[model samples]
Target chain A: MTTRTPFDIPAHASSDDPRVTLDEALGTFEPIPPYPPRTEREAEFYTLRDGEMFVNMGPQHPSTHGVLRIVLKIDGENVVDLDPVLGYLHRGVEKLCENADYHQAICYTDPLEYISSLFCEWSPVIAFEKLLDVQVPRRAEYIRVLSGELNRIASHALFMGWFALDLGGLTPILWSFIERDEIVEMLAALTGQRMLFNYFRIGGVNGDLNHEFMSRLGTWMSKATHQIDSNNALLNENEIFVRRARGLGVIDTATALNMCMTGPNLRATGVPFDVRRAHPYSIYPELDFDIPSRTEGDCLARYLLRMDEIKQSLRIIDQCLHEMPDGPVMAKMPRLIRPRPGRAYAAVEGPRGQYSTYAISDGTDQPYRMRIHDPSFVHLQAVGLLTPGNLIADTMAIMASLDPVMGGVDK
Target chain B: MDRALRRRLEARFGEELTGPVRQRHDETEIRIAPGDLPEVMLALHDEPDLRFRLLSDLAGVDTGTTMQTVYHLWSDSSADWLRVIADGLSRDDPRVPSVTFLWKGAEWMEREAYDMFGITFEGNRDLRRIYMPPDYTSFPLRKDFFLPDDASRSPGGGVRPMEQTHGPTNAETAAHVRQASSS
Candidate 1:
């Protein structure tokens, strides 16, 4: 009997063995190398000081959000440096979009940020609409904002739960998930699916606000702010939650801007830059809401900022409901979609940050190139910058505060 | 479109620009040579009137003949998104300067562009592949890149499922599975 190793072939086996070439091929797919460091970053990360050691948080660790592996270089409990090893959940969505037609490409983008899939669909749809020079009806624009804000609220609810759960609290996740479930259910009625809703299309949204969705939103809105306040009351003053998150992973404004952070993370640093406000797309210019910000730039500040933004989102939703113009939801369009050969960049301020898509058309049905700029990808880089001096325990807390969904990060 | 901002850009980079500045919708685009990226980017970042501090996005494009790196910038100076297209890079070895000096955030975006299109950022210290595994050789987003199943990728292979550039063969996978179940 041959001693078995992972994808190993017996050393004494003849070269003519059928498995020889296959085994050699399998060897290259090894996730970790049995060999030494190959690149400069790998060498730097692998090398350790006398008392320091490397700890892998996960591609499987519960706190990583999704299949994200963070390599932490630690001396005692203090993280000396960290490297984020990504591509674990990479679906090659951009490459896939290049092969698919414009309308079909929106469906491909739906799962990039699974928590806020509507925003994922929104950017690409807007870009395609720009390429086609299609003017969507006013009612459709309002519905997009209405449904998008609902998704944002749901996402923030989940973020609150996950953030609290990461800091050794259990109750908040349940509360947040319950809130998130209600929103998801409401969204399912509006769209067809619970998650990864391919609701946004090139011309407009898939459907108008139906009775089921309207009823759910009306019920949820009456007590939404109160429920959020009650759930936040559980952690907003709790000593452990505050102590763990407060003043931990502090990033200042200049450093935050230099890191290209947007959304809540940048807002927590007092930038006041929301893509919806700064670069107005859709009917956001018609809506009135403040871009809530905090000066501290700590994990606590980030958490608190999202809680505040939930109110702002609710305000936007309320305004969207009251001011929704009566018209057709989708515009008249041809059967086949082929945008003119040009480039379009469209971004929306999602719950996470700026979810943008840059689409280049070559007068063909399929996009010549489609690049998705996810906020998670930009914010994940800042983790390496933020975690160097912090303790190991605070690593997850810091990451949770940033709220990086690995789907978006890896896409 | 902001014509003044377009005019200002033309006046500033008229000589260095490869093509005329084009403004459409809410975007103003400029085509520049690869050599002028760093100089132009520096001016856009530092100039008091045109302080485009925010690096909104960086994208890579393959025009079938030439490779291009597109950068989108947002600033209070201009209402429109300023796009700088570093055009006409050699397809054989597409190399452009990195913008990490101005926005440290451009590092990963540049790395991704390099990973997908093989466009090397000359000044990026950490120019490793971001998405593809370290052993991957071919740039996936290149116009010529073909899947293993595609006839053009491996001619006369009869669509061999496991004969991809990075994946193992069926026999090897089965062997691994058998070994795993026993363990």
Candidate 2:
């Protein structure tokens, strides 16, 4: 039994080194004061009518995704106002990245959007690469497109499952997980880890798609269409599902743009703006794909748009496989990757929305600033704005429709 | 295209331009004094030619010498991405006017700016901390306010978990969660 006390310092540990011991360093930082006493009442954000009351929804509810607490001020089943209290999942990721090396930070991004972590990791990788001006080979671009589209399918598939599950169904999620697990397994074959595959490197992807990966992808592509068709046949045609989803929580273009919602949620509002087409990052310009959008701007519209995206993603993957060029995946780089002191904003079309990263390097191996434009974080705010007038039960459907993963929201 | 933007912005907000309109390889941004932010942003939003309607992203950075708040704007019609840097905010008392009135997107972003950099947006109505607990005094994003035994140290890795130096998260919980699953 070898249990070591933290106080047992090594003999070689120097008293001279400030980092070695606590020694007055603990006093430097001000401690966070505890929240207020139970008796003291804070001013209500919403003035409730005489009979109205406030309902506290989960900080740990299944429906809110992950530890998302929403306080709804309701007046007879109709929500008068709602406030989203965030920060349950915050780990000071930005602060940690500021201290870690540019390349070392890629590992930290995996947990940020665990569902579609590849897309989450893509923004920072491309942003850091842009600042360094590293030239990714054409082959690497094709691989990225292939893997990214597959990952997108996996993400939206998971969404398809959960979106239905949240609306009181289990079978859709069962169908979703089957396809999702297969995709994850194939991804593991390509990238080593299942979820949060830190596969993207400073220059390019960590590795190339093997023959096994290619053949597996070929098999999965055909199967994916069947799965999509099955899911569409199962859910979209269901009158009950359609009634639950359609014409509920519609956001107009002006309001959607103002609130800064992105991806399918924004596209649902009739804006034909996809960052892939709009920004022209990677080899998306060369790839033949259409930006699928919906004019309805409701829960069903958003749902259908995501379904449409899966078909488009498959199209992109097919093109990448057919038009793939042969070359090295990684770009040549200096031993220590220290980009020059400058700023760059690079964006990728995340499964949910615009997963943008803003990188500022200060001539050090570490980045000065790495700010993420998390789509879920922005989308969560819509809960406050849009949820006010809707029915209390509809909040889940509306939130589910937005496709929020707390990894992105609370990062 | 950037040359024309430089000319147009230069002709409009001449003296307000803190540095030369820096049009980098990937990003295009015009640096302006913090006081000139409202005027420039309003002009950028309302202008027919330069219709930067969407406030895509806003972030604050502490660059050793000074703190800067950067805004990324996307114009729908023209398909142009623009970066606007509002620099020279006091590290001690960083403040900028809230753009919430202009664009509702700035509401949460401005709160985030306040939470991370202590950069108060003057006109923002709901300027409470978004990520961190309301009581947390120190701004986590600043270069100086570090977690205990940060990994940058050359000596060794941190033996103990982190203390409550940053935001709502403390190291005790982190340590407990990281322990072996079997036990």
Candidate 3:
């Protein structure tokens, strides 16, 4: 396969055009009012005069999930200011998409949101199919749903594992992975890749599920559910876990709605705002499930909501397997997919939140411009809001509850 | 609520929702003049039927000659989405008004557009680089931007030599080896 080198601009380009350069522009750009100075003495001399310790929380910390650094200003325990420094994992996915073809681009999307790779694949593929108005067969939709649900389970499993690890429980992480490995194996059998599965094509999936794969998947699903139930029972009943999680980083429904938070985080705030139920896509309307929500709007509520959602996902997967029709997995698609000049935005309920792909195609095989609206990007905003009044010790727990996958956030 | 709100939005926004407006696949686009974006967006949020409270995403597309800023706005109350496009920003001055004042989520979205597309948000609080390094040079997303080839630069210019071992295998080397006489 042919591969092009990543684009790199000359260092002197900024010197030639200072307006386009961030450093040059920021040199003269005034800092926001009520700013603190760089050094301790300088900061003390400033208006807010309270002695606050400045600590950088990442660029290396384990809770970040990837390369993410947050420069935080703390007054004793409460955070006064937070500046998230990104780009440590910025592989220039957008720039790469520009050069890659529509089919080739799907490979890149999976890696962007590594945790919910299926949702990432689903959003772009569905967007491409919509742009082209390709009619995917019934079987394809069922397969898509099956894979999507399995992906959701895997994603939530990872979240539960990491969340338990964050809470200083190691055994749950290992147990959660026991199910994750089965799901990954199923995905690999279908898609040929484990982590970054570029299985979804424009019109339909890359291929059909074999009978042997289906039986194996069915066997794994039963065991996974029992494991999920036992794990939830273990974590939920612990008094220390409840004390640390319940009522910590409490956010009301109003704030969540105002901020446009989606997925489990918004549901935890007592708003049944799941994209699957509200704006049904990929035969989700035909499925049997309820949007799990909690009225407490706290860390524990969010955790419980995710646990319950996993059960709902399992229900969807079972329904998909039972009712899955036999037909063509891939719809009839043109060799070159050239859509009419227009734009479309297709969003799916990703593990983190609402993952949307907005594609603008000027009647070409490749999109004119594709913009991805990752939920983690918006969820990161909630971090600054929730951490301000909480203790430094609670920062990791609050962040873990949010489950901000740096891949999605940075991409 | 769904059908009535869309109609009310179309009526209130008048010509703003008319001609040159197109729908493809799942995305809907309503083209508006650059000067009219603020008024159109304000009406979209204010209208009872189309309470698009959240500005989900804002991005700039460089179409060679001109730039088009696309806004993806969603309503949590209604579960509907509206994509508004404002086209025709001059290459020299790619400035657009900040929507962060309306939706708090637009704070970083605008910063990202500014960083990648060099689209200036007139009143954005943080306009620094969001994805690229602080000292990054050109806007890499533009069509004219090209990745420099290591071998093209002069050796004494402090330009690092191309690491021949990395990246895609060179086709020219294979061609040269094939052309060589049998030894």
Per-prediction TM-score, please? Answer: 0.90, 0.88, 0.84
Write one digit per residue (lDDT tens) for candidate 3, span B1-183: 245445555667677653444443334457787777778878777777677766667778877666668888776555456678787776556777777666666777877887777787776666767887665556766554533442232244343322222111111122111111110
Which is better, 1 or 2, measured by lDDT?
Answer: 1
Instruction: Choose the strongest candidate by DockQ.
Output: 1
Model 1: number of backbone collisions: 1
* Segments of candidate 1 deviating more than 4 angstroms: A1-38, B148-183
Candidate 2, residues A201-291, lDDT tens digits: the string is 8788889888878778889887778878988899999999999999998899999988888889999999987889987889999888899
What is the TM-score ranking, best to worst?
Answer: 1, 2, 3
Kindly indicate the candidate among 2 and 3 with the higher lDDT.
2
Candidate 2 global Cα RMSD? 10.6
* Candidate 1 C-alpha lDDT tens digits along A1-411: 344453587778887875565423342222334567756767777777799887878888999999988888899999999888889998889988987778889899999999999999999988898889999999999999999999999999999999998999999999999999999999999998999899987787789899999999999999998999999899998998898888999999999889889999999998999999899999999889999999999999999999999999999999999998898999998878887788899988999999999988878787878999999999999989998988898889899999999999889
Encode model 1's per-residue lDDT on B72-93: one tens digit a residue: 9999888899999999887677
Q: Is candidate 1 or candidate 3 better by TM-score?
A: 1
lDDT of 2 by residue, B1-183 (tens): 357776777888788888887776656678888888899999999989888877889998776446689999887544346889898776666778878888787788888888887788888777878888776777777655656656445334444344335332321223211111110
lDDT value for candidate 3? 0.75
